[model samples]
Target: MLETINRFLQKWMLLIAPSAVILGVTIFSWLSSYSYLVKWVFAFISFVSCLGLNIRSIRKAVMRPFPIIVCLVLLQLIMPSLAYGIANVFFANDPYIIMGFVLAYIIPTGVVSLMWVSTYNGNRALTLTIVLINTLLSPLLVPYLLHFFIGTQVSMDTYGLMIGLFWMIVAPSILGVLVTRFLKEKINKTASFLSPFSKFALIFVILVNGAVVAPYFRSFDGTVILIAVLVFIIACIGFIMGFFTARIFKWEKGVVLSIMYNTGMRNNGAGAALAVAFFPPSAAFPIVTAILFQQFLASIFGRLANYYFHVMRRRIDRRQNGLTGI
Candidate 1:
């Protein structure tokens, strides 16, 4: 039974980080309405789960940084505009409504994308490279991306936004890097024991975001449907493209899963915060929902990828053993 659990985790590790947050949030939120303690505890847990990404053997990761850049540029700068341009044709009548749709595109990469990517024994170093660069570049790129593309709805207070972003993205990145550098060898020793609860941390974030959006869902009439459709489209596109891109390059399962997280995950935490800080509450709704939906869908996709990878490995092993007479 214990071996079975270990096998399950190894197969689904990358995907489980986010699941931990989503599921944790659901369980905690239900267990406590008056206890503010639970939320803060889980929030820190969520942050730590993501924080693990910055711990790097950086020297090893820098060898091939090109794919990392391409993904960041494509996702941060190009994708939102693509969504806006496409959604415009469909949502021209209600531009603000469409702005909700564009919210998904304007969002940046998930730092936690690196963490889960690590779970699959993915290109942790590569993911760290992309996430760190994307996060640092986000302040300049995110605002400009919104201004040029969906600037009509999402506004940026340059000083306020930059400063706010620094605390959230930069500060976290630095602290995480520090932790990983100093604590890596130590933490790795206990990683096996602590990994299960890591799922709770990731799942907590998603469920909390979902609960946050649940209230907003009541306020808006058609926002949920529009945001859902647009995000779901990008999620599908990101997942499909990521897999093929990995296959085309003949990347290992880890690299493929890392890219999947990079492509499919959105920096909705940053996006939603900007929406609230810079715009009205209405603008934040879609951004919030986008986070939940992307995580949920990506989790499903991650499972499928894990299953296929395991099955494929067995086939190759059988062939090598001459068991199948290949």
Candidate 2:
């Protein structure tokens, strides 16, 4: 019965997710009073989500380093550059928006991205490897990326950022791996039972965090709409670039899916938190606004990729049949 219900939830997860966020915002905006608690929830979500990974997958990714290198290049270098370029063009006068834009891309990919990768039958090993590696490196990388792109215009709490990354990502991941090593069966069972709840945690995060920005949403101006449009375009481009690059490299289907997601989605939650903590409120605008559309875009990209994959398969089948007859 549990398995059946799991399947159902998984099937409609994309639809259910956005709805939950909307519902959460509508019903629990007041819960924003305790938004500080969301960090622990974020940590818990990270732990359980990664609990399923084992040494074998991590080793596999290490053994074959090409995909990891390619993914990292796409994710870290290409996407950040793209975001910076776009921000410079769109908001040349506003350094805060530019900082926000670059920050969104420079942060590590989200932990919840594993859910999407799993939903689309992606390479779990590579996804976990990329997420863990990115998270592990984010402390140094994020600050460097920020300095490189924005120069000394923005002030960063380097120590605070490091602490946040370690606690939110590295610590939870280590605890999760330990649980996997020593209490494998128990952890696995618990993760399975609690897996769906991860989505709720995400929704709650979005809700509470969304409320913080709700005031900004109520009084929108031309600049706000422009930022939203620009973000949407940049995000779509990330997916496209990842998809085409994976095809060029002739990666497996699962790897392709993994690249699509890892390239497209930023750890917006962390980005928002960092922005609010270190930078001005204006710097967090892009990051906060992104939470609304990131998941929605993920769904669209997944379906689009599936459609194209099927089309290519049908073409190959037809060509094979024609050659057989000849």
Candidate 3:
């Protein structure tokens, strides 16, 4: 019974997520009171999110390197370049804003993608592999890319960011994976019970993070709207690029789903966390606004993917029937 409810909630996360963000921003005063708890919320989210990952699945995906390599290129090279260009064009006057824009895209693939992949029946091994590999590499890659792209113009504590990623992401993930490895049966049995709570934690994270930047929303203007639009467009490009990349490689449908979500939806939560921790409060604007639209796109795209797969299955079945009749 509990598992059924959790599955229902996960299926409708699209609606639930955006609603949470909106509610958070509306009651900013109440939410802001708990502002001090944002980091701990993020830490808890990371820990619970990792509990689902299986080391064996990650290893299976890693052994098949082609999709992994393509995802890395899209993640590291293509997405960053696109984001950097967009930031420079629109936010040339403020280096912090540009930093926010860059950080939004440069962070690792999100742990949340695992939820989407599982719901859509995508290759769990491949999704887990990409998420784990990206998470592990983030401690080094995120800072390096920031420094490489923006130079001295955008000041960030590279070492500090690395340390944060290590403790927040790397350590928690390893802990979860190890626990799952040793106690697979027990963990699986308990997962359904705990799933809803983990999701509530995710909403709590969003609400608190929204409250942190809620004051900015009150005095919204043309520039804020423009920045939001730019972020949305750039984010969509990530999804579109992922779609093309999957088609070019002629990947299996499951692999294609993994690619689209991995490419389009980054762990923007990491971007929000980084902005709040290392940069000015205003630097978090792009990352915060991004949370609103990305989830919506994921929801839309997910429905479309379902329709597409259904149509393709029908076509294949018809062809088989025709062959048998002849």
**TM per prediction:** 0.71, 0.90, 0.92
Model 1, TM vs. native: 0.71
* lDDT, candidate 2, 18-104, per-residue tens: 565455446655765765666677777778767767788889888988888898998888998999998999799989889999998
Write down the worst ten-residue block by lDDT for model 2. 16-25
39-147: candidate 3 lDDT, tens digit per residue = 6666666776777577777788888989998998899888988888988988788888888888888888887777777778888899889988888899999999999
lDDT tens readout by residue for model 1, 115-216:
467555677777767667776777676656556765554444667756656665666556655665677777554444445554444344444454444445
Candidate 2's TM-score reads 0.90
Rank by lDDT (best first): 3, 2, 1
Query: How many steric clashes does model 1 contain?
Result: 14
* Per-residue lDDT of 221 in model 1: 57
Best candidate (score: TM-score): 3
Model 2: per-residue Cα lDDT at residue 281: 58
